[model samples]
Target chain A: MQNKITIKNLNAWFGAKQVLHDIDIGIEKNGITAIIGPSGCGKSTFIRCLNRMHEVVPYAKASGKVLVDDRDIYDSDIDPVEIRRRIGMVFQKPNPFPTMSIRDNVVAGLKLGGLKDKKILDTMTEESLKKAALWDEVKNDLNKSGVSLSGGQQQRLCIARALAVEPEVILFDEPCSALDPISTSKIEDLMLELKEKYTIVIVTHNMQQAARVSDHTAFFLYGKLIEFGETDQIFKKPKEKSTEDYIIGRFG
Target chain B: MDRLKLSFFRSSRSKLSGDFIFEAVVGLFALGILILAFLLFRELFIESGLSRKTFGLSFLFTSTWDPVNEIFGALPFIFGTLVSSFLALLIAVPFSLGIAIYLSELAPEKLRTPLSFIIELLAAIPSVIIGLWGIFILAPFIRDYLAPPLSTYLGFLPLFQGPMYGLSMLTGGVILAIMVIPITSSVSREVIMTVPTHQREAALALGATGWETTRIAVLPYSRSGIFGAVILGFGRAIGETMAVTMVIGNSPRISESLFSPSYTMASVIANEFVEATSKLYVSSLIEIGFLLLVISVIINVAARILVWKLLKVEGGKVA
Candidate 1:
């Protein structure tokens, strides 16, 4: 399989404290790779580093090379705005702009990309919603305020919003931790289907979810990657003691 | 066989009485404000009865202010107050927004604290002291430098046609604009800062530029609060007395020129109230005071309603 993203010697810091230790990994194109770790294990920080979002936080810095399709994303000439466009992100909370309507929320990224044709926006809105598996329920109420939706629907809307931008890779930072079981399954199914077309990196606290949805699983502990392998191999016969211990419910 | 249960009135007698007394006391506190307002209006109306009877509604529309003949009208003061306050808002809004944006979004963390402290210090300077500075520093600067160049180029416009006087409506407005910046900027900064981090992230994640992110997310979220701040500033501006009196030249006439001397309601009352020799003159001044109070009350009520509706329309929850 061809790799879409390659990382080498990634180190991140929050002021004086280094949160992400030296790490190296490659993510395959058109597949789901899950990053599983306990809290404060730098899973979020690692994904944030891919889009240069970690550096946006005051006093936070990173020294690393993140390559998207053989082009180093961390190069001085590369703009973070362009990098973020190529790699979209979904936050943990279902944070739809409260002032915007459902239709407006879905097309927000497109508008930011400077797409203003009403007909195109209308078509894309429906298509993105369908891709996110939310069109059937929300098609009739497109004008409703985004915040008025249920939590599950809001998450789906955010997914649709991310899809509208047509990013090559999408990052999920615990996208379903706040969702119900039904909603979680729906998103999981959606992600599985999306992996056929777009590369996805999911940071999940749920180990079972990582095993169920991801083609590959990477285990992170104390800002270090302990093991990266096929999903079944990582879950069933992890090579590292820490990885096996984590998978089997030992100390996180 | 049926047993009768206690009626709500009889069963909850102690609770009902307790609620009644509690509500009455709370209602009395509410009624106290209403009574005080009513008393204030009644006294002002009675004290200004001479002007009201003699001039009727023409008192507002007429421009005459002859203390000797006791022919008093409030049009000049009203016009001056409206124009000066409007001009102040025009000058202050842009500068205030800039300060707010810089402090909340762009300023370095180390610089933000001291700069915010400086703005608070601006607010604490007494109005009389500001007036003193206006007379000594601001008026001369305007007369010597600003007015001549502005009049030379823009003299075709009636607003810039009149001869320059050191003390004029423009001087008062510029000083008022300075005084208002502190309140407007501080409130706007707080409002912008209250927008949730996720909102900013959401916009940035869409590949929007920093300015675009602020425009789409931060600004729309805090618009109502900013509007409330502007309204508060406007209210403060109209009610300002000593500083405006010092710089506005105490001229009681309708004038289009920024450089022309003019008067406002509060300034007029402050200038003439203590010096009035006749009952009619004093009554006219009280009428002016009543008019000022009424205008302020209307503004406050309108602002409250507008802000409430704005909050409903925007529906932005600050996290």
Candidate 2:
């Protein structure tokens, strides 16, 4: 598979403490790649670096190369806003714009980009919600406040919102960690369907989730990439002892 | 062991009684506020009975104030109070929102604390000292520098016409705007800060610029709160006495021009309360006080309802 994203010698810091050491990983196009690690292992920080979101925190900094489509996103001339548009993110907790209606929340990104044509917005909202598996549930209540939905529905609504912008890549930073098992299974199914058309990267601490949904898996420990291989290989025959220990529930 | 258990039971019983006493004391203090408000209203209503009976509803519209003849009307003072408070809001709202946005979103870490401290300090300065500064500094500044250009360019409008006086409604409004800014901005800053980090990230991840993120995410989330802050400023402006009385010229007349001297209800009360000799004259002044109190209560209730409605419609969930 062709690599959609290439990272080289990436490092990140929050104030004085470095969280991500020199890292290199290539994300394949049209496939789900999972980054698995214990808490505080910099898994979330690593994915945030992909879309330049790590730097949104005060005093947080990142250095190195993040290239999409063979062009460096970190180039001095590149706009971070433009990069972010091409690389969308869905956070761990669902955050639908509280003040907006279901229809408005779905089209928020398009409206922000000055797309005011009503017909197009309506069509896009429907299509994105359908893709997120939320259209059937929320179609009748399109005008309701975004937060009026159940937690699982809210997460799906957030996914639809991310999809509205039609980004080339979508990042999920432990998107289902706050969800129930049924919701988690639904999101896992959605990721499988989504990978057919978009590059997908997920950061999760759930090793079983990684084993179940990912085509490729990277295991991180103490800010280091301990192992990376095919999902079957990583689970069945990890090359590194630390990866084996972690996979077998020896120690996180 | 039996003695120890008995003591424990006794202590527990005493603690329950203490809790009840504490609750009753707090409840009484809360009730005291309502009682005090009612008493104030009763006193104003009874004392202003003569004016209310003599002039009836026409008193609010008639614009004549003659102490010697015992004739009075609240029109000019009402007009002046409303106009000056609204004008203060017009000038202060933009600057306050700008200051709040900068402090909450754009200010560097090192600058945020000191800038916030300075704004709070501005709010703490005595109104009497502000009145003195208004007389010496703000009045002259408006007369010499601000009013000339406004009348010269926008002179066709009645608001900017007439000769510029150092002491006028314009000066009063400007002084009120200065006094209102710190409170409005600080409250707005706090409201803006309450917007969760995830909301901003949602906007940013959608390819929005910093300004766009604030416009879409931060401002909308804090709309009701900012409105409440504006209302708070209006409350302060309407009731402000010392600074406004010193700069408003204390004239009992209405004119189209902001450059003309005018009187506000609070200013008139502060200026004439002690000197009011006739029973009718004092009653009329007290009636104006009654009107001011009623207007303030109405405004506060309306603002609370509006904020509450906005929050309810949005489900009151930031996450």
Candidate 3:
């Protein structure tokens, strides 16, 4: 139950418009934390700020501190590239490198770091795919284009790609919203399994999904953290009125 | 009920005829292009019949380009076109690709649009003006400074051993390279932009540097398209006439040096077409035109085959 990430007074801006207000939350080690909110409530933006992905957009900026394992990730001395390697992100859509083979896609991160050892790459690709529950399906056709897979399988492939880097924390930006129910169930099961090894944070519009998979849930409303607590307490006995209204199918 | 069915049947019949007329008009418009190409080929062949009959295929092998004797061979012009265009591609491809990458990946938001527009504006200058500039500035600069050092240091090479004339194949190639940069860079920028955000995200999320993301994810996805852009620039460089004619010295010879004056098929046609008095002279020029047509066809067909082969090698992705 030790904290892995500590957010302190973070605010994000896209051009002149502020998208996230002052926010503070701590993500614990080896557990899934879900951020549930209405559309445009800054849930995704909040997570993106954790990995410094928000600043990639033109005119987008952020201020304040996000510390991972007691080290300030926002310090000027730290390289964003190094931070990203340690904290991987999986996008909502299945975004396998279209031109790369299944094996190449999994090992893309390793290649970027100049790891060209063929035996190590082969072993890592297999291990990562197995961890993401995709090895059995794609092992035979390792040379096939990453885009050739079914949508559900493509999502799994993307997960394997994220896993290939062996990150400390993995961010899922609504990873299963575009998936079917069966795929959703599989991903949910995978996340539950993944939390045993790595810190996980998910931004979800599905309250049920947050309730089903998260150990800690943070409810956001109008760029504010309305409630943050254990999932059971948040769902059964939220201290905030907004959290209760939102979880009970009241107004978003 | 019978009356309603009769009206419905009549309407559908008229709709079918309407669709047929629309389809036929578009089809005929497409057919016009083929017909025009065939007609142009026929005219060139018919007009060049004298040279074709006299020299047969040996016209391509011979280097004699005497107008008075009614003897002409396209070897020099062919060599000029290939060498100049090859050099142009060699110079332009890397330079333009750098510009393309800067625009696509590295340029700051405020600077990106204006810089790209300015780069594209280079294409708008008339080729005649470029040729004039080449004659006045580039030629003198090369003769006085660049060529001397090259010849002094690299005299062992035949290409550098020749006397430096300001107006030579090098000048023409450099001019062609300047002329072709805009098309390749702009098209390459367009190709690079087609790489989806998700693809970029996938790479960047893995802790890749900006350069690595662009190199591993963006470039590989758009490699074929960038190649196509280069080929398009090559097409422009090979067939270029006015600027090349003015600067190429209009001499038909096969020389080992870039400092030597040479001729290209298009340049020869442009320079002598009006003054060509003899039937055989016109025939030879027309035959050169035919040769140029054949060369372009071969290049395009080769590109098509290469693209197909790439697609087959990489599964179903676009080449």
Q: Please, what's the RMSD in Å of model 3?
A: 4.5
- Model 1, residue B115: what's the lDDT? 100
All candidates in order of DockQ, best leading: 2, 3, 1
Q: Is candidate 1 or candidate 3 better by TM-score?
A: 3
Which residue pairs does candidate 1 place in steric collision? none
**If both were scored by lDDT, which would come out higher, candidate 2 or candidate 3?**
2
* TM match of model 1 to true structure: 0.89
Residue B73 C-alpha lDDT in model 1: 92
lDDT by residue (tens digit), candidate 1, B35-144 = 99999998998999998888999999999999988889999999999899999999999999999999999999899989998997998989999999999999999999
Each candidate: what lDDT? 0.89, 0.91, 0.88
Worst 10 residues of 1 chain B by lDDT: B1-10
Model 2 residue A38 CA deviation in Å = 1.2
Interface RMSD of each: 1.8, 1.5, 2.2
Instruction: Give per-model TM-scores.
Output: 0.89, 0.92, 0.90
In model 2, residue pairs whose N, Cα or C atoms come closer than 3 Å (at least 3 residues apart or on different chains), thus clashing, are: none
Q: Write the per-residue lDDT of candidate 2 for residues A1-252, one digit (tens) a residue.
A: 799999999999999999999889999999899999889999999999999999899999999999899998889999999988899999998988988999999999999888999999999999999999999999999999999998788999999999999999999999998899999999999999999999999999898899899999999999888888899999999999999999999887
**Residue A149, model 1: Cα distance from true site in angstroms:** 2.1
For every prediction, compared with the true complex, DockQ reads 0.51, 0.71, 0.56
Clashing pairs in 3: none
